[model samples]
Target: MLKNKGKRAYRVLDFLHEHVIAIIIAVVVLAGVISTIAIVKGDVKTSSEKENSIQYEEMSTIYFAMDPVKSLNPLSSQDRDVYYISQLMFSSLFKLNENLNIEPDLVSSYTANSGSGTVSIKLREDAKFSDGSRVTAEDVRYTVSQILRIGDESPYYEYASKIDSVKTSGSYSLTITFENPNDAALDNLVFPIVSSSSYDDSANKIVGSGQYAYDSYDSMKLLKLKPNTYYYGGVPQNRIQFKIIQDKTKTTGLMTTDAITAYVSTAQDADSDAEDKKLKVTKIPSSELEYLGFNFDNKYLAKKEVRQAIALAIDTESLIQDNYGGAGITSDSVYFPGFLGTENKGDFYKQDQKGASELLQKSGFKDSNEDGILEDSKGRDFQLTILVNSNDGSRSDTASSISEALNQIGIKASVKKVSWAEYRSEVRSGDFDLFLGGYQFDKKYDLRSLFSKSNYLGYKNDQILASVKKLETCISAEQQKETYEKLKTMLQEELPYYSLCYKTYSFITVKEFTSTETPTFFDMYRGCDTWKWKKVVVTEQKDDE
Candidate 1:
């Protein structure tokens, strides 16, 4: 009876064990199905979040055949573009706003003590560099010292000649004392500040107090900048990519292809082509002045009447309307329109071909050969060589137009096209007679440097120098203006160079990016750290969908 009962119990236990195994298998299968669904749902949710939260990345680049001199140091290159690019990587004590008015960037405000040749600057306490370091008055003093010490042959040295000492009085205050007070003394203080620690000899590495810092730069290839995480102000877009496309035509092509977002203009009319379809163009008053500068030592240019005749003969208005697309303004004097003390009364200059011809005849140039060409009394043809940089479109065009105009007046004018380097060398050595060049006027409206004894042209005028000195020392703005006006009238009479026109520059940019303020001669890239990108429609994604 016991064996039979045990057998029944064992049979029941065996049956239950078999059913439990089947149930366990079913539960495992069900769990696997549920886990698969959860994973699929999580993946879908992650993809949606990525699409919604990610910032759209875009890049804007400028093309130039020449690579920027590896340093963002202000004293590195004299080229305006080099300075421009460096401004993006460096911060200045003072910056100019759209109206060509002085606006403080790193500095909140500054006062000039004309009598002591001293300048006191107040900095914004909240100003911090691209690095996490705070920018202090000590940085300003150090920058001034570095510029004066290391920048011997630099343009900065020439501008900062008056500065004898620089020191910090407080955490946010800086004092600069000049040995001699010059009118352009305060203006010369505008320079980029760099940390002594970050400055290294590495070719493309940049550590700056700017809106952007170097992400990567391969010589003559591409330069990439990423927004500084520690920036104190508005940050630029995620990245800025600079591609090296030297050919202007190719640059425009890249714009059409959507490979580049913008192109800043070196030409007056950069928007006059096919790329306009994708870009909006804005014109800014340029500080650039296109002129015909005679090597002062040139025998032919030494004659006052000869210089006057050439100035009179050039038809500025026709050249402005034709080559400049009616975008240029006639310059009556050396000072451009926006200078502190410049007074331009339009009638001071007249485009009188008849008057020019009379002056030429009086200067001993006559149509002796009946070939419609003038020759001097000594049979020296009234011919002049006008040199221009081949890369400069505006200057080259103006040179050609002037040649034509001179031909009309029986004066033989020849346009000599040369590389910019060669032209600069020739102009500096005083080897050429008349060269087509441009002077970029700075914020102070100082022309003394241009006409100084040791300037590029080596043109010396004591009267002009004295006037510039007075303008620098004058405490009152009105007094400074009066002094500058006096100097302009005097320089205009001398005709050191034929001031053709003050050019206006136009640029086409993507509307999503903010532009520098008006009369944009001052550094446009100053507040780049503070520039924010507006929303852009990424055409890569379908809007309708």
Candidate 2:
């Protein structure tokens, strides 16, 4: 009977196709037939009700939120969302772990010689691409070549620029030479490696050996992903989906509305908002260092005593609480606390009103007229103006607080807020006394580039730069850490720049997970490779009379 029904249905469809075009349309419309998704953006209702239908794995699945993708090519595009989704589909030789330490990913191990500026890497024999092909040393060479080909536009350019040459010893052994001795050679090799044989430069196709593989993509809606069967790492989530979000500000709304299950955000109120919605939010510390930049050329402002006094007057603890909502780590040193097995001596540079006054008096500055303002021995009036970008609410508030603190300490100060363009112009032109600045250091924490930039502030300190060079040549990690300690001490003593606090970001999710590793700023999806999921349990309760 079933076979007869199938034959009759086939015949009816064939007759309809040969007899009338309008009847065929009616049949398709009635049957809810869906066509293959095309590359287009609109609100057209797909017959399946969703664009690019997903094929789920036999295990668990997770939906993640990302901004609209302009291109799937992670190397060529400037989209952070694209970079993030690509991490799920691609594997790299080295990756930043939960503690922001560089560890081997696809490679078995590596040997570096700082004296020779060379590094030798051995790939994992079991490593394979999504196509089940062995990852060769040639592929590593090709990946670095592509990054260098993109010039400075590629985010990996800075890391790749130090690589003077790449030479493959065999199918799985490769050697990299740097322009000069670099202690961060291992950290610089954290870029993703692609299969040259499977990927085409002209096309935006991605072929990687990560935990997930490309399943399907609907132009303006969402991209579906399936598990990579050849993946060596354990697949925590069997399937994954990335919903296209054109506006990032709508992430919290979509999460509450069930449009997406999880997302990562740096917004100040992200944690609070998640609490209101009863969603799980993980607070993670980011590496973006927030600090105060000073113009050292001004004679009166160039005194170390004056800078130290100002630093003491500004309450860093209060700034972190008021401006950051207590979502930051306060520090007098620029380095992240406890990094590289380093120790911090308590009260090294905490706020002290008496200490601040003593420093000002030591600098030969005093309130000669007793009018709540300071003047030099020569009766020279002193004042400072802090420049901040108007778009950043937190930094703007910080500037205002610093201004008020200085006023209370008998030092005249004010804040100047401007658009991003004008802020940069004023700093570069040396038209400002002080400015609020932030730097998102690379995984390597390359301080050389930061110190070697053109003399925009006309700030000179040969001793500090020398210390950094020494830090680069240290052969052992222990020696490097010791050298960095010396460098941090010099920075504090010289007061070339002021170190403020490090901020934190939040990762909010609506789904229940059995287990998950902490994520870091270097890789927000650090847990995807090992995360375990659990089905949401629903309970029903009854009220009896």
Candidate 3:
């Protein structure tokens, strides 16, 4: 048996020696296959773990108000809410920063020829629409053409009317010629640009080169916006969801619940509940100029002395405090506080009842009767009716206060609170002696609409008109500044309109978010991209044995 086993071992050794190279190749191949399978299984496990970790992390969502938007069409809509949404979803040739200064949006650079009244805008090569298509000068020309076609119906028509022609200089450059030189021509170009091929004049959905793209609007209740991957600007992390709740009461209620992440409200609307909910309230200086517009056609108001006296009799500080809840800044000029032409002209026409009375007396108004009411040369009592929009509680209160103050000064004044429609009709028709109205001025600072001969006030001064025309035509900022300074002095002396105050607005957000710096009406989301989410991460403890 030992000999037979020895012979078998010897045979096996000989067979192994003969096939050793082939066996070695087979073993190496099998080892490589096993190693590859192990590596693939390990990679799959690691990928699954990474994906699960990312899925477990929460993505932040931001909610804003969309109730005020009536239409999404940039050319047709003038609603503030619509403007805000357009700012997000549509890219303009230019945009205003937090300082309210015009900056380039789609244009990489621009050149203006003041002598020729032409502007050439060079588009960025990489600027693209939401659909990843390149933005061209033809798109801008098409937008301007559409705005012009709308005529006076579009808010941008005024700007469009200034353009004599829009021609594409190149694939990425556009040259626009104006009929006349305009200092605000670049400022007027801030209107949004839409894709020429996509627009159907339907106001359905907007497609542009803005930072965001329209996703969906659910029956006017909610508006969903997504970051545009093709945006010239980088994409943001949080998705924006705007809730359209028109009722202020309902909006306030949503603030307490998690339904709304942020809301905008007046300071007066920031109640205790907002505090309990730990909302951070931010105040923004409004561009809305609340002033007392006089019907210059009125016999009494047509007299500069009468208007100046009325301006001096009322206390602007007291009126702002009592009527506006001290939520407004006193304004002495038609321009807003930070506007280019705004200045302190030694507080002209301040509350000076004695001066007002002396001025009235010098103007040939006297108390002919013992009734203590001033009368003109014809012995007619100087009774002026002050009209206020009934919809605006603050303006109505201010009108009442002005009437009381005038009555105290022996000038018979009465308050007439009229509906908004009626107030507009009366003011437009010059049917009121005095009216408490507010004007939300555009960034252009064009006063032609308020001071021209065809204006509601019928106020036309040759020197003033000439100054305004010069300011519009002025080529350089220095020249514009010099002209505006002279215009300001003239406006102060003439007292065409009593520039009362600039209103303020309040915005409410969760305590986790910080308020934007120097927010304006046009750029409410100025710093929204920098908003941080205070998220907390939790980890499970491991058992140690």
State each model's CA lDDT, in order: 0.68, 0.76, 0.76
Clashing pairs in 3: none
lDDT of 2 by residue, 1-545 (tens): 99999999999989977889888778888655333233134435434343333232222666677777668876777778777777788888887555434568888977878788888889998888878898889998999899999888777787788788899988999988888775445667777788988777656668888888888888688888888888887653557778877788778777765556667789878888888877788877678788888787878668888888888898888999999887777655666655555664422467887899889988898988988898888987668899999999999999999999888888889999999999989988988888998888766666765465455566777777766666554245556677778887887887767777888888887645434576677677766655554444334333332
Q: Please list the Cα RMSD from the true structure of every candidate, rounded to 1 decimal place.
A: 17.4, 17.0, 20.3
Q: Write the per-residue lDDT of candidate 3 for residues 175-214, one digit (tens) a residue.
A: 8888887543577788889898888677658788888888
lDDT of 1 at 16: 81
Which scores greater on TM-score, model 1 or model 3? 3
Tens digit of per-residue lDDT, candidate 1, span 335-415: 666456355654244667788788888877899879998987888777778889999787799899888877888878899
Ranking by lDDT: 3, 2, 1
Candidate 1: pairs in clash: 98-517, 98-518, 183-472, 211-529
lDDT: the better of candidates 1 and 2? 2
Candidate 2 global TM-score: 0.80
Query: Runs in model 2 with CA error above 4 Å?
Result: 1-59, 180-184, 235-238, 257-259, 325-327, 336-338, 341-348, 470-479, 511-516, 532-545
Write down the worst ten-residue block by lDDT for model 3. 46-55
Please report how far candidate 3 places residue 483 from its true position, in Å. Answer: 3.7
